[model samples]
Target: MNKVHYLNSHVEKFREDIKITIDVENIGDLTHYCNLHIENKKVTKIFTECFHKKETYKDLIKKLPDTVERLGLFYLTTVYWIAYTCHYHNDKFDEAMGHCLDSIDMDVPLLNSPHFCKKVYYYLNPIDEVKC
Candidate 1:
């Protein structure tokens, strides 16, 4: 079994209606996985696993439309985190920027929009040197 190293994980109340829990882990060899659960009037859970050797960034980005369809306006933070992790580990900043722009195009307010905006800005202008 591949050992998992968590990059980040947290649980928090999102807005007044939803609570979100997210776990992002690197399951060895640059493979990344995210497990996210959101609870409001109903329960929604999603698991996305990407293997670096087997998947290209384009493949990862292609899943966004389906993800947005499934999750609607909720839990995009975890998606952004997964994108950031994929880029950071693979040095694929340009693809990361594309992922961020696509997420923004969904045009819903994220639980932490400012934080996500900062990440997008850093991807556009790395001279600012903000830590993700």
Candidate 2:
């Protein structure tokens, strides 16, 4: 089994969500994967329509602090990419581990900054994305 690492930010509903964890082996590649894809139309549409905040990726990026916004958008877009691949393209997450870990890395930095933590809560709370 591949080793795994958890992100400090996670979704807690009826149960905690493991969606933020990533394979340890892919840690080195996270930045590459994240940088490769900046704009996703499908995820953008979902964020704008499904969520009440009416947040397009760029909107969230503009409103939050640079580091916080980068992490948040990276996290959101990565998850959206995974969902998009699974639901629309029929790709299993295991086949998309690179992207998954990239998104997970986005949240790793927030673990160290209290300010960013608060910002993460503020940014994520509106979308029902996670708990601090």
Candidate 3:
């Protein structure tokens, strides 16, 4: 969310429920606002791409930290857009912010990939399960 002006975030962690509050500068001329939601792990409830088994989604969430950590700028940006879209639509703010900060610990990456690369563009349409 480079173009996005990050404002603040709040987290409420309980035994079974984890809620997150994220505030980002809105697109266009809109004022900043907060988007909040609780964490959900349902496979069919998050990713737009379909998986044959629920375990795959679980595994994906499990591996998200390593994946984002290892991602080049291009991929990270891709993920950010997905998260930003999640925030924009307010479908799954927790999942979006979770992936945004790497779910295990809420720490933003200091500096993203520094390699000079071409801008990449991705197009994802909203699906019944996940909104792009």
By TM-score, the best candidate is: 2
Residue pairs in collision within model 3: none
Provide the lDDT at 116 for model 1. Answer: 53
Which regions of candidate 1 fall more than 4 Å away from where they truly are? 1-47, 51-57, 65-111, 114-132
Clashes of each: 0, 0, 0
lDDT of 2 at 61: 44
**How well does candidate 3 score on lDDT at residue 63?**
38
lDDT by residue (24-44, candidate 3, tens digit) is 332211111112122223321
Q: TM-scores, in order shown?
A: 0.25, 0.27, 0.22
Clashing pairs in 1: none
Could you give candidate 2's per-residue lDDT for residues 1-132 as a string of tens digits?
Answer: 323323222322234334544433332232232443555544444444433343343554454344334454556544433333444445464545544345445423333343433444344344555778
Error of 3 at 111 (Å): 6.7
Query: In model 2, which range of ten residues has the least summed lDDT?
Result: 4-13
User: TM-score for model 3?
Assistant: 0.22
